[model samples]
Target: MHRAPVVLERAADREAVPDDVWVELRRAARELGFSQIGVADVDLASAEPGLLAWLQQGLHGSMLYMERHGLRRARPAELVPGTVRVITARMDYLPRATSDGWQAIAFERLHRPTEATVSLYARGRDYHKVMRARLQKLADGLAERIGPFGHRVFTDSAPVLEVELASRSGLGWRGKHTLALSREAGSMFFLGEIYVDLALPLTPASEAHCGSCRACIDVCPTQAIVSERRLDARRCISYLTIEHDGPIPEEFRAPIGNRIYGCDDCQLVCPWNKYAQRASLPDFDARDAFDAPSLLQLWAWNEDEFLRRTEGSAIRRIGFERWRRNLAVALGNAWRETGDAALSRALSEAREAASALVREHVDWALAQRDTPALEPGS
Candidate 1:
């Protein structure tokens, strides 16, 4: 059952949004495609230590932006001046065509070994654009009701600790995989935040429900999840393919399987995701090109075709270089797993014209044909 809309109470020195106003905010957010909304106080002092520890361990890989922001990521008031409260939102992103047993379906993609498995999230339009525009509209609706207030919006931004705010504001609990997970919505949704000067009443946080389940930790392809709520991103395929600019690490290449972009193995195995919801908007619908594409098929795309096909998609942001690099690694894995001559031919053909970084990966991929497969856990 939906939690009743929160009642706003007057606090000294700040205008109190009426209970009816809170109802209007909920209505506006819902109309804007937000599944849930909650307020979190700006004080995130307690989360700073964990953020610092994660960065100190060099687990963030080459994503220096996480360290550049420092503790400001935990302290909302520091990142956005005068922000007294954060309005956190969640929007489910599972494509509407998602079927029952979707997790099993995702697992089946891995078994194919030759198919290019883009993470489900990136299979649709760029969610950063979709979520930002909707968040701004939600903010505008709030302004229309209570007059203009100081506010800024963020969606998957580096400077903001999104899961920290989302879990603290009753959106969900931070799962063992370190992504926000909800009992009702699972971990499949995207999160956004509006930093506002208003001192809105804070919502009670959600309780941890992961229990004794270690499915996420056990299911990771590269063991990126070192422990509960701890991730070593250097080994994470998502980080390597999308964020890391260097050659895909040899240790992780084979384990990355046919995932040409981000990996969803953890979320795919989480039992709670059985409750994942379908998106209310068509903006997240999967494009035909991403639905079970082959390694050679994607590798066949020249830079121009890559640019044209990935226009307005999140995959484009990685640029053609990393795109080819990731494809090279996946093609290598496909060749190793299937011994398919077509994949080997595609890898060799691309190597001739590939950039230095991509060519190195292409060379590595071609060498996979000569390497014998190791037994599980070897």
Candidate 2:
């Protein structure tokens, strides 16, 4: 699937790439469902210190791969030799059927302890599949025009600093939550990159718009955002539910609430999200099952059913063990909050049949029936 790298025969060959190529690429990107596209130079040495600090602090938790990749993440040429300019793309992911006041609806779900609250981005097909295919297509279209360039496409698949490249290329600015934020598209979009040897015109970086806003930080159920742009990923709910593979930390269980997949508290509270755009492609539309699934409803699924239901979803990546583990914690929280006999019954019935990890969580959930349910965010 790899193409031979492009080689310049002479010094003049470097200038053969048309300067107006970006204008045509942007038009092709829009046709392929990307919301915006930009070009970034590959000098990311300025970002290496911050990336090193984050990793050295053990903020990445169990993701040892981050430590393994090291500075190669900051150097595109090292990862893919000959990378000079990177093409960055943004694609909005809000479900096309999303209504007005969607943030309120998200907040409402958090208050309802028995309802399963998945992050908005994961309610549809796996974005890795959706984005990777489109990105490859975008690269193919460019090859058609520019006639075979040395390039490689990436979404969240690699160690490249997505937000840094994104912001540098005028896609958006880094918001308080450390997510790339655009005035026009907000933070509810996915980012992808194509590292190419072509010396394309660089896109100007956008200015920071979050003046004094602390909504994203204050609204975090786990306070994962330690400072304006610094995040402790270990404490992030999205990381807890999706990345951390072992048992859910006891401290974050209750605050984790009914979020079985990822959390969107920060994005939900951001004022800029009021302008969040919906998906141009139907691939991001929410399935009927994930829309308003209840705790017991999801709890009823065995491994086989779990696989069948989550076949093409990002949720499937967690596998049934972690999936059940997350569900058990949410169920425990639900048992304490409502003391619903059915919730208790569901947990008890699954206890003996569950995996060791899931069984432990199930036992913890059953114990919640005795503890007083604290108020949300208390």
Q: Could you give candidate 1's per-residue lDDT for residues 301-354 as a string of tens digits?
A: 888999999988999999999998998988887788779899888877777788
Misplaced by over 4 Å in model 2 are 1-13
Give the 10-residue window scoring lowest on summed lDDT in candidate 2: 4-13
- lDDT (Cα, 0-100) at 332 in candidate 1: 86
RMSD of each: 4.5, 1.8
After superposition, the stretches of candidate 1 with alpha carbons farther than 4 Å from their true spots are: 1-13, 374-378
Each candidate's lDDT (Cα)?
0.87, 0.89
Any residue pairs clashing in model 1, and if so which? none
Instruction: Kindly provide the TM-score of model 2 when superposed on the true structure, using C-alpha atoms.
Output: 0.97
Best by TM-score: 2
Quote the lDDT for 38 in model 2: 92
RMSD of 1: 4.5
lDDT of 1 at 12: 48
Model 2: per-residue Cα lDDT over 221-287, one tens digit each: 8889999899998999999999999998888898888999999889998999989999999999998
**lDDT computed for candidate 1:** 0.87
